[model samples]
Target: MVPMPEQSPPSATHDVTNQPPPLAPYDASADAALLEGLRREGAGWAEDGVRLLGLRAGGTEAQEWGELANRHEPELRTHDRYGNRVDEVEFHPSWHHLMRTAVAEGLAGTPWAEDRPGAHVARTAGGLVWGHTEAGHGCPISMTYAAVPALRAQPDLAKVYEPLLTSREYEPGLRVPTEKRGLLAGMGMTEKQGGSDVRTNTTVATPTDEPGVYTLRGHKWFTSAPMCDVFLVLAQAPGGLSCFLVPRVLPDGTRNTFRIQRLKDKLGNRSNASSEPEFDRTVAWLVGPEGRGVKTIIEMVNCTRLDCVMSSATLMRKTLVEAGHHTRHRSAFGARLLDQPLMRNVLADLALESEAATTLTLRLAGAADRAVRGDEGERAFRRIATAVGKYWVTKRGPAFTAEALECLGGNG
Candidate 1:
């Protein structure tokens, strides 16, 4: 293994990166009104994320991790499915802090898997929302990110899974978990030829001699969360392409034949786990209707995209939060940064722009709620909203993050 570290000894420096995390039960009741009963079920974890976000450095394991996370946000030379090192990759220690907080607070039940968005859906939809997209804003969509339950049910694969998606790919059996907090991963997608042509994907699903057992064959360009145990794989059936629940390992927790050709790197979401996974006659189970695979996946993907928006919104929020904190205290050219005319103007813009992003994300989430519930509406109308929300939010995301980052400056 070229690079895989689990529970390594803390560095002797003042950096608080290697301390034990703060563990506590998450208070679902407090945020219930805000996130709509997201903590109703699942285990309760201590929610001390704000503390991490508000770090002044030097404190508990949680605090140190937060500071370390911000310091080490960039990727460490790793490849995507196409053998390209993901350069823009960075770490979100604050996010990790929250993940651990969730586990400690009893918000998550799984040992290593933490699905806040899933918990959000399960709680908000009263169990109606079975997929991802939760508390932060809306039903985020990305089949790879949304299909987390598949990971929760399996832990042995966690070692191989988490490492595979890091900014640096682990060599062989070297990947391992360092923090006992929330873990996140991702994959890629496209609708064009040689560009993730989902419709024309050569992948096929054929029934085996045994019933309910199917063999997967063909090349899939993107398989998000390939490192995780559960895979939301899409394959063409007799009708059209659909998703299959392919585990990283078999029922007994053994690595399967599914081959990961390479990991693909990208500009945005650099830290998110992704790859060009290839399943060659791999064994899997058909999740829903044979012909309805793409349709079913669209539902999952729709929710995940919404998730991307939520995450984007949060990133935007955090960027401003850090920026505001710095400008308010730091002085520039013998004057307080915030008092400067130009600085104030920029800060105001950050405020309005971020607020706009948050509002739009919420509205989009509302529309998604209706669509997912199958409420009264013309198909064309829902389709338009889905398309627009997906486009508008994702489109608006980068500018938001960029502006916020600029506002935060060196500290951010």
Candidate 2:
């Protein structure tokens, strides 16, 4: 938590007209622009913040995502037991479209917008793209387009899930857009016992060889996104872990073989769904190769992690800016809070640090952009670099948020 600067008493000679009150009038425009922009380009999102901070634009996708995350606060009230929990929150389809536009628009001027048209698809009509999205990196959406090669490269979803994402649905199955309303119902991953450690998972998938031939037999505790059409499950195979593309819906309109065991009542992000589920001979399609389960799952996981970092980081930055404005305008005794020697110094201090964090994040993202374009050296160092960053920015964000909340006083 950021320590609040000392508040001084008002001075006697202070002219009421010279200084205005400190309470920040709610301004939606500023927060909205940054957030809406984040769904576009990362550094570009913080370019405005950098100018304000008097630093260069260097923040990462994580930082930009942090700012956007902050934008959700109005939507997130407190959860006494859960602490900063929100009852409900979701992205509107239009929100995705805006991000896509930002990508195209952003790329026209910047270098990181490789997936402009793809980004546009994500922004323009993402929700409908996939039902019960697995994770954040807009993977549920991006994969809708990205995994196409993997999807079509093999006979996998090419005849199945592919058409669902595009305007056409290959004759009989769920459509993408309507899939959004399909409420996942449940998921199938691991438990406290293990997550990525699929080897420790007790869930089992049996083979029947009846064309699509498959059956699930086991319990999946802590499947993260289980609120849609069904799930893409992973289970231990004789050779190793295997990923099965499982559907939540069945032919008779009956629930799929999967059943919800419980919903985790989380502390911070109550709006995001997390659950434990059971699968009883559930029908499914194997994704990628049979024994290559771990590899396939990583693809999905990577997508979510990226999106998560962006969203979390976006929230933090937005909160930081709002707090700064609040402090700058509020006054204690004679002068505005921002005019205080201590407050000004701290604000200056925060400006440099936060901007530095933002820039660093962006540079990493740019590096990531280059890397994805195939830049390689010592891969290990990149993660080491990421660790250096995640630690700094994530920490400072909350500190800034705490300061901002405190700055708002009882109003917060």
Candidate 3:
């Protein structure tokens, strides 16, 4: 009878999950550095956009979209059901929602959409806040924002696309630019052999009978945002390396020869698609004067480079917020993690760094706004701010991310 004592089941496990999941800050507008800097620097015009992004950044919808889009990476559909080479990449619905929200919030094209003082600063503030929700989709949004200044080098080219690019609506597809209410643009540089040395590109562009028109024949090693309506590509023309505007859909409702060979399986930025595209006699139009592609493309690159700085700064702020949130709820030894002395010191350091980054980024953005209005002092300061801020912030991102992740231990 003693041997008949009840035995417990073998497949039982303890319920022991700890450390709350770190969502975005409850209100990005309430960020001390962000609000203070905006007021001190006379960028109060951007407060409304920042507040809106703040309200959504920590919401359930943003959290779900941020998690799901990255979890479900984009699939490259090189062929259709009937075996036609469509070269389209299919995405989770979450990706589209993220893009639509970002576009409608003026995170991308606000500066170009409405030209005014504090325009770039306001847009930068909104972008920094929105970027905290998700970073991958920001790639296309940033590219579209940066593409404008470069396109302006050719007034004729800018005239056609500016309206679409600046539209608040978010239209995603391969439809004609004329038909779409909003548009996105991508950049194609860095061939397999060239990397950043675009001058070493071997892609050839032969002219058509029509002036300023050409057909490109070459391969792009890295093309960010393949789904974009149009891309600014660099190819060798009779006059040397030149910038050209290549559209996915040609003028006559026909798909161009821009073939997506394959999509890159990246370690990060899983929500966004980067690909190697083969341009087989791809029709394009010259962007700027021949052999001046570097000059024209540099304009675009500068804008993107500034975005890199701002994005890195936003990541730092995001890391601090997440770590701070986790520590406040997580317990260790005898008290809350944030209340402990050693943990407090570490977090204080991170907060200091984040604040510094926010100040510098917003200051630089303000400088850009002033530069456009012809301020020599701000223009000069911007050169130094951009170079130094980008170098310092990006270099610190990886290690900072590691430390912040450790704050939540296994929960991270």
Candidate 4:
């Protein structure tokens, strides 16, 4: 009789509740600060395209793409099964998807190609929106965008590569630059001994019989996006440190001497491949005046710094949005978390910081737009503002994200 006692079914203890819904399927362009800044920064005409990209970036598919891309980090293929040297970085399909979308939306080097007003501003706005999806892919995109001005230092090189760099097509693979529908760019400035002090680089560039052509010999400690079609490299020339354009594939369809020593084990940004590339007899073309590598690459550095500010702003905004959503739907102490005065204060503070970053970034974008239009005042402002913004905004990002994560308690 005791054995016949009915066993009680296991009581359910895993019911999901008090959790905010996924943040996708909402309009990322609906960001009040971003929209206001876009209009204020003279990119109002691009609002529609920005909104479209925002929607795409906020979709479930794009969210999944980001997750997958990060989860499956880029793999460096140093050699083929047949023992052939194939210094290629293989990425997940999702990575390619993100890249394709970014290129088609003109978030790479398109602004430099466009002759319209606010082109840079529009590109900046679009980049801010799309960058919210993922940060790693933005590396090559930013470099591609930055490479335009530096490449212009050598008009001959610019004439050959600029068109592809600005093309609204995502052509992945190492091929002759002219053969590709579009191209991406990367940069190699630092070495093992010299990091930010690029002037100390020891890579040697020996000029060939052909004018402007040189052979590079040395190792780059950090060269991100090695799979890119081209890279802006720094090396020691007869005239001193100088900048050179190194392509993965030479014009004759032969692989250049870009040996990927190994991929960097980074703390973050795993979706991008950062490598120590050994340049032994690597074919390169000199860019800018000899002995003026720093001056030649400064513009590219400024553009990348602006991108850093935008990236920081995007991070702050995304975290704040997550926190806000969680507080609105999550309840504790017999009321919605959003209703708590202390939580409200925290949210208000985060909102203020996020808005400030957004406003500052857009202002810099405006300055870039006007500066490119030959405004000396705007150019000067952009130079100073970009440096300050890069320093401040990027520094604030970790703290801002940490605080926003705290808002979600353990859920974060």
TM match of model 2 to true structure: 0.60
Give the better candidate number (1 or 4) by TM-score: 4
Q: Count of backbone clashes for each model?
A: 47, 43, 0, 0
Model 4, residue pairs in steric clash = none
Question: Pairing residues by index, what is the TM-score of model 4?
Answer: 0.97
Off by over 4 Å in 4: 1-11
What is candidate 3's lDDT per residue for 118-149, written digit by digit as tens? 87888788877777777899999999988888
Let me know the TM-score candidate 3 reaches against the reference structure: 0.94
lDDT of 3 at 389: 81
Give all candidates' CA lDDT scores.
Answer: 0.46, 0.46, 0.85, 0.92
The candidate scoring highest on lDDT is: 4
Worst 10 residues of 1 by lDDT: 127-136
**In model 2, what is the error at residue 75, expressed in angstroms?**
17
Return the TM-score for each candidate structure: 0.60, 0.60, 0.94, 0.97
List ranges where model 1 is wrong by over 4 Å.
Answer: 1-145, 148-196, 266-270, 367-386, 408-412
Please name the candidate that would achieve the greatest TM-score relative to the true structure.
4
Superposed model 3: Cα runs more than 4 Å off: 1-18, 21-25
